[model samples]
Target: MQTRRTFLKTSGCLAAGALLAPNLAKAAKVKDIGIQLYTVRKEMLEDATGTLKKLAKIGYKQLESARSDKGNFYGLQPKEIKKIAGDLGMTVRSGHVHIDKDWQRSIDMAAEAGQTYLVCSSLPSEGQTVANYQRCADAFSKAAEACKKANLVFGYHNHEYEFDKVDGKVLYDILLDRTDPTLVKMEMDLGWVIVTGNDPLAYFKKYPGRFPLWHLKDMDKAKKESTEFGKGQINVKQMLQNMDKSGVKYFFVEQEEYPKTALESAKYDYDYLARLDY
Candidate 1:
């Protein structure tokens, strides 16, 4: 694996100002900057080739796949998408595989995509009760063990629902406590955490290093959905400052929908990260 400095140079994304600016005095050591492909689902489904090339040009060296409308890597199949990622000098870190009958196929797809991690972004709605939560946690524990055997990391993505109290304990707490930390990691979504009335920084502090991945998104202060990075309520700089201690490895910029074009939205995010000294 290339150092982030080398990767940035090779990807041709050294910010014009960063070219002259001194090294970030207190910058956290980030391993990779990725993009959640779901942010540009429309363009991806319509023009996978062109869209991917554009993302690569924008300095996205890794991708986190979302389930397509047709399911399975925007209808191109797993191996095909992997080839595209490789050709573009990008890696597919992980993908949101729907929990379904084809779950085994999803694992195979992850291998095909050359992904080191495979995640289930959501849990089934049916099994959300206290009893179900324990069972689900156990299931995830088993899955994590299986992933370890396969030489892959398995993780769960979070939303507000996890904060709901179950038997006097927050469901998220239960899941975290019960699951084997070594086997199952977390993918923190800062925006959703904020939306649900929790503090992102608090979690980063409390769960130092438990999160290996994150969905980099910003929440609109006045709006309900996601917006551009700096224009949102989330203090991303503060979040980044804590990442090193938080053990976050890779974070993917993800804007579900934006007022402007997806590329433009992503550029704004990149610019913000680049401008910050930390």
Candidate 2:
């Protein structure tokens, strides 16, 4: 009883549904959103325990610790931090660490903390050349082997500099191409990608499932700095919609600049993400 026009309409509807179904499934699987503690660095330095409690109360279910003057784990030892976060119904699964000669020490500490990831926060050496980046990739592979032995995953967090072109090829691409994918997992910073005028989606497409972690910070287009979620130029909802393509297992909310107190801004970001629907 169906006419040709009706059959065509039904087929188109089914195609659209097929396209949307995967994204919806990925979004629904996302739970236990995390925050990079550096967003509240000052407060954390003064009162690590109290600040973590506040973040936990705000519904953050995971954390990524940043190095502090007090210590790598913010004055407390690795085991101590793990216990505190665990008691609060949260987990400290990753931390930003420097890739230095003492990297093995960092790895040892992270393993003791029950953390799964040790992210190199910056390039170990500074160079804007393809050769330099390739060297860095070699070093990362070595470190990643140590991490594998320690039963931890190693990753790198990129900044805008990585996007610079050398010899007409992006430096980040060189790093990606040279490094072993299993050894060097990338922790993509969404804000920096926008600030550098690069497309995160392009990277996701080029290197699908390589990014297991993300720094979900938004950039203020005018200031070119981090800002509270939903108040920036980044299309966060679009990114979340394509999370499956990025292979993101965990993401951390991080804002370096705030319109108000850090705690208040952290709460705002949490609420914004919690309310956002992909």
Candidate 3:
């Protein structure tokens, strides 16, 4: 079973031994540098194909879309987006889906986009209470089963709300405890986890191999809000050290609030991660 990393290396691009090197000397681990396409939503909406090409040139190999609207892939048809990615030699590993009406259409759209995973980026506002969360958990269980039938992994992305206390227990913990682990994996957004006043490492230690994907963003020191990966207070290097145990297979860079241009923020994240000892 060849992994994406293996496929890229076997394309006669890099030595096999270089693929596993921790420092990633020459972006050998392309999947390691995935971009949450939501970061460039403005550019993507303007020109999906051209944006993908530019991202490929910038060294981004994998992509995670926030969501599709009306059968469109970031504003284009799923098949169109897939073809664009194929032409540019890019991969769409995962995408954001919703918990509402005709989501199956979205699933099929993702399949058309050549995506391997469909992630629920948020819970409906109605699913905000304890009972509602439990209902959402049940829905996730069913959705996960559906994803399995479609040969796609299903996951949930988190926000600060999940960390709030309900009945003296963390809502996030309840969601984790209630959801069928085999059915639903997690795409932990590191920035939101920190913002919710939780320790990212602590959750990793507790969950242990449950997080297959991560949103690697940072929080400002003064504002305590999200910033570019390097200029923020989150200790990403320390967090990344536990990837082996945390089951972090894919990590996508995300910056909801750009201090400057979003591309500049992404470049800073890329340059900083590249320089890390890993």
Q: Rate the local accuracy (lDDT) of all candidates.
A: 0.79, 0.90, 0.79
TM-score of each: 0.85, 0.90, 0.85
Q: Please report how far candidate 2 places residue 180 from its true position, in Å.
A: 0.7
TM-score for candidate 3:
0.85
Q: Write the per-residue lDDT of candidate 2 for residues 156-265, one digit (tens) a residue.
A: 99988999987789899987899889788999998898789899999999998889999998888778899888888998888888888999989999999899899999
lDDT, candidate 1, 1-278, per-residue tens = 89998988866765755664554444544435699989889988999878888888877888999888867688777788888888988988888875667767777778777788888788744555777777778878877776676678988888778877766877777777788878878898888888878886777777766789999888885676888877778887778877777688889999977887988887777666656655
Predicted structure 1: clash tally: 1
Error of 3 at 108 (Å): 0.9
lDDT of 3 by residue, 1-278 (tens): 99998897777565655665545653332235888988888877777777788787777778898764433467777777777777777788899878778678878877877888899988854655688888888888888888888889999999878888877888777768897777789999988888777887888788877789999888885676778766778888777777777788898988878868777777777777777765
Best-matching candidate per TM-score: 2
Which is better, 2 or 3, measured by TM-score? 2
* Model 1 lDDT at residue 156: 88
- Per-candidate clashes come to 1, 0, 1
Stretches of candidate 3 above 4 Å error? Answer: 1-31, 68-72, 125-127, 221-224
